[model samples]
Target: MEPFTIYEQQMQRKLTRWGIRLQKEPNLLERASKSIQNRINQVIPDKIHTTITATVKGIVQTTLFGITYMPKTDPLRGVSMADRDAKAEELLSLYKKIAAAEGAGTGAGGILLGLADFPILIGIKLKFLFELAHVYGYSTHDYRERLFILYVFQLAFSSAKKKPELLHTIKNWPAISQTFPPAADVMKQVNWLQLQQEYRDTIDFRKMLQLIPGIGAVVGAWANFGLLEELGVAGMNCYRMRNLQDKAAELADK
Candidate 1:
């Protein structure tokens, strides 16, 4: 790895601060929100909850395992990290607009169309992560790399209470990922129920408001835009951390 320039050092400092913030414990309001979300979950029928869990699990499983789509390798492999990140920011901007449009269209259609937004948004988010991986010069062709993408997804959508552990896992991914089994086995290892519950709890209230008659359109557009923005930040930083660590390791060896 090349030596870090003065600008890179400044960026690294900013990233370190962000990492610390990511691992901090949830505040009181966040805890209260989680409690309220749990109560709402209690009132939802077991059957509906089970269905949603199964649906989400299946969507993720298919995305990871299915042959329907494969991410193209990045053409900018030898480019500087700064250059790659600039391209990544452009991609994020494009996807943000796409997500907001999708959100607005579905949100204006009331409950049924609002339901359709779930899978569509998931697809957009996952596709963007695949592209982000490439921009960072990582190959998603490897199942392990793909698994890292999933961890990034979880880190973005997970509740504040769950963020620390996920952040830690991501930080140590280079070592921890080695112990992972084959792709099929790794898929089975996922706790679908927990994954679904945490994700739903985090977004359900705002999404439910997207089902409302009159204001659904505005709510949906705003919510989707914010969600993608959060994911973009998390994904970029996760990759940035990996790249910086690799550079540091290379320098240490020299």
Candidate 2:
């Protein structure tokens, strides 16, 4: 099947699985416009970062709720690390393991038996990706779209014969372009710009980039551009509504 076909199929499946069936046009555009206007007054720049963090946290909770091996909170979930070197070393070791395991060739049709282990790694990767992208200058919309595109690339990689490490695949911008075209180019730009800015910092941002695909850099940069106060609210509210409906069914069964 064509890559675009695969993308559409994946999107369709995700939407359906999320119980998002629109019988007709929802008032999305109008709602979004109103949200931007109403919320901006309430969404002070000082509060922007916190709101964004909350929005992202909610999205993580909603999407990977039951995805096998994912985590409920990101690895950086609690506590601040005063020792930059120690924190950097820990992140590096974890990324190295993920890269090495993936590089060793997981093969096609591979599935993780461990669902509980996924959330932290995935969440940390996302958090790092968003921060990196922001330092380089991208919008939240760009970050989201790039993330969706990268997910598609990851799925396609599993279909191919090569046992590619996430770092190796991301490092090769040309190959990424084969999977995601112009999106890959945009990601490279974002990643490179961010790296230059953070080069002297004590943060192990580079290792973080090497963990996930470079697409995250694009997404993060994009997200940093503005306050995404309503980023995950709609989807989250939908997820909650679905959970409630399911509970209602269980009650009926009893």
Candidate 3:
């Protein structure tokens, strides 16, 4: 057997384990966390929530509707899923380090950088996810593909209630993507407000600690590193699911 083929088999096995975990119901601990998070959210000032939501909306709108550099996914092909993911991880690692460094610097400044701070991290995550889409051989030029990037993103940072549904959308993305026509406006189907709210609410507390003066730097680096790590896991496995399932379909027809 060829080396590439052997690596692919190993990846497929890992994908199997990832898939099982994806669909498993959230346990009691997760539910309790959600409750606590909700209580915390209720205590947060509405102004902070509004500001975060607006900032996210601005970036997300620009990223989704703005002109893109890549031509299309068809022109970009990888030798194998394993190679693609290897490249993906390389890019993800670089991004994680960059975010950590930025976090450390900003964190040292304390709450003085509070509002300005998170947007930088948010921008980093957005850039990384869009880049990760390219690594998966998807065109950032297509709105639908950008939408898919957000889906992977939400899976990483969203409340547990949203994960299973997002996972389902990812599992069925091939069909869903096919549902969109060249001129179709699918953005209406998505709740933009909800998307931003989920993202902000999820990170609000942890990121708040990143604004502290004394301990802020350490918390910032660790928090930012973990955030990217979470996104990397969610992003890679999401793409892996599509690749493995598509391969299964190919073999089934044979």
Give the runs in model 3 whose Cα sits over 4 Å from its true position: 1-4, 68-75, 181-184, 250-254
Q: Estimated TM-score per prediction?
A: 0.95, 0.21, 0.87
Tell me, what's the RMSD of every candidate? 1.4, 21.6, 3.0
What is the lDDT for 61 in model 2? 38
TM-score of 3: 0.87
Estimate the lDDT of model 2: 0.32
Query: Residue 221 deviation, candidate 2, in Å?
Result: 28
Q: Output the better candidate (1/2) by lDDT.
A: 1
For all candidates in order, the CA lDDT equals 0.86, 0.32, 0.77
What clash count does candidate 3 reach?
A: 0
Q: What is the TM-score (0 to 1) of candidate 1?
A: 0.95
- How far residue 177's Cα lies from its native spot in candidate 3, in Å, is 1.8
- For model 2, state the Cα shift of residue 231 in Å: 24
State in Å the error of residue 12, model 3.
2.5
Q: Which pairs of residues collide in candidate 1?
A: none
lDDT of 3 by residue, 1-254 (tens): 12336767887788678767866877898778777877887887988778767777677666678753333344247457767888888989999999899888888877866556677887788788887777777778778887788788888888777877888889899888788755236655567667776786677667878877788989888889989998999898888777777777777776
Q: What digit string (tens of lDDT, one per residue) describes model 1 on residues 60-179?
A: 887678644357565346777788789989999999999999999999999999999988888889889888988888877778888898889999999887888998998898899899
As for TM-score, the candidate ahead, 2 or 3, is 3
